[model samples]
Target: MEVVFERVEGRRYRVGVRRSGRHDTGPDVPPRVGVGAPVGDVPHDLVHLAIEEALGLRLGIFGQVAAGGDLGGFFTPPPADRSPLRDKRRSQRLARAGRSDTGLSESLAACVGHDGRLRGADELLTPAELGRVQRRLTALVDAWRATPPGGELVVTWPEHLTVRRGVLPSD
Candidate 1:
């Protein structure tokens, strides 16, 4: 798996991921997946694809940011250069309420449904979703603690992207 990061603005990073493919390529062309979201734009499709590929199943999971902070600050190549005449109020709402945290998990749950099952568009997160992300992070830390480090996993925190990673110093 290959992870690509493009600087957006502030602490935000636009992440592009390409991983091992199971599909076969034509004799003349290589099979490639183009997953992109316009800078500063929410790449929901790309995110869904990442989760599906990572977890081996599609999900109704959604990523949200708080309505109080700069949304572009979460990804790389942010779209701050756009017109400011847009709806500042609604934008603020999304910024403040849409941030990643339990809020993200909540939104994922909402997308799938309030029930914690992974049904059609109503399935947001399974206990497995939480476990998958946690395990992935732990493995990264463990690998770093080991020798001959190889894989790269970027964990971004523009203004602290929190989602329960074991216990903090105080806990």
Candidate 2:
């Protein structure tokens, strides 16, 4: 799935996801806008993405989105598929996605916002992996700050972060 981060102006921003198998976001695109006063130089969700990708949190927010979960209406569903039963099954599938390092991702994201660093070697990430997160955050924040208002900074949430097709995870 494609993650779109748009600079509305100043600290205002909009974030939206284009799910897999989707192309050409026309006028009907759901406006997943967030007007947040983010603590760090980068948006909070962006931090989550960077940290999550570095640590590989498959059942995290973006991963759920990639697997087509609306994430409690953070994203809007397609107009064509209106079946509530289908939605229920999707939710069930997501629940079956089980635990991920989402809690860790959140903690690390908060750490970056406050202390701006991660200590060497822990259960969540090793020294090298922490270094990777720092490097990635640096690059992503640099690019994000450079983007002009009304412009988009596109990102990809790895689809394989979720379960493989047809291999139903036990509930």
Candidate 3:
């Protein structure tokens, strides 16, 4: 799969994916999936969730930075204590905070659909705290491409900042 990260404006970027074929030129061509956001607009929580779901790396925000900012530093979580009361309390807290563990899945569903059309382009992230999140995302993407779990995955950021197919890695 080819993933193109195109700058739309300022720090805003749009991610597009194509499952097959080389980059083509045409107005009618549509990516298999697409999502757009400013670099600062991408949530740290969501990035962490996506890394966990897509790469099976459970390096939580705190631990990720402490481990020298690499995927190899990820470690398995300790087994949770099987307590029904604790589970109930945790669920209630999450509900109150309007957060869910399925953040990655829900975000993907909102952005990319079965028809591959883009959606939810207006969701704005909270202002970045210290630019650490952006750095974290870059590191995560580099690690993902280095050892893609499923197959060859390519991610590119266009120089001209247009929503066109980026140069493939093989090019």
Choose the strongest candidate by TM-score: 2
Tens digits of per-residue lDDT, candidate 3, 66-160, equal 21111212222223544445434433332333233234334533443222322352352333411333344556445443442233334432212
Task: Estimate every model's Cα lDDT from 0 to 1.
Answer: 0.31, 0.65, 0.32
- Model 2, 24-79: lDDT tens digits are 22112365666344545567778878887776777666665666555434545445
In candidate 2, position 109 carries an lDDT of 68
TM-score of each: 0.26, 0.78, 0.27
| Model 1 lDDT per residue over 50-86, tens place | 3433343211121222111223333222245543433
Off by over 4 Å in 1: 1-81, 85-90, 96-130, 143-171
Q: Which ten residues in a row have the lowest lDDT in candidate 3?
A: 62-71
Measure candidate 1: CA RMSD: 16.7
Ten residues in a row with the worst lDDT in model 1? Answer: 23-32
Stronger candidate by TM-score (2 vs 3): 2
Give me candidate 3's TM-score against the actual structure.
Answer: 0.27
Q: Tell me which of candidates 1 and 2 scores higher on TM-score.
A: 2
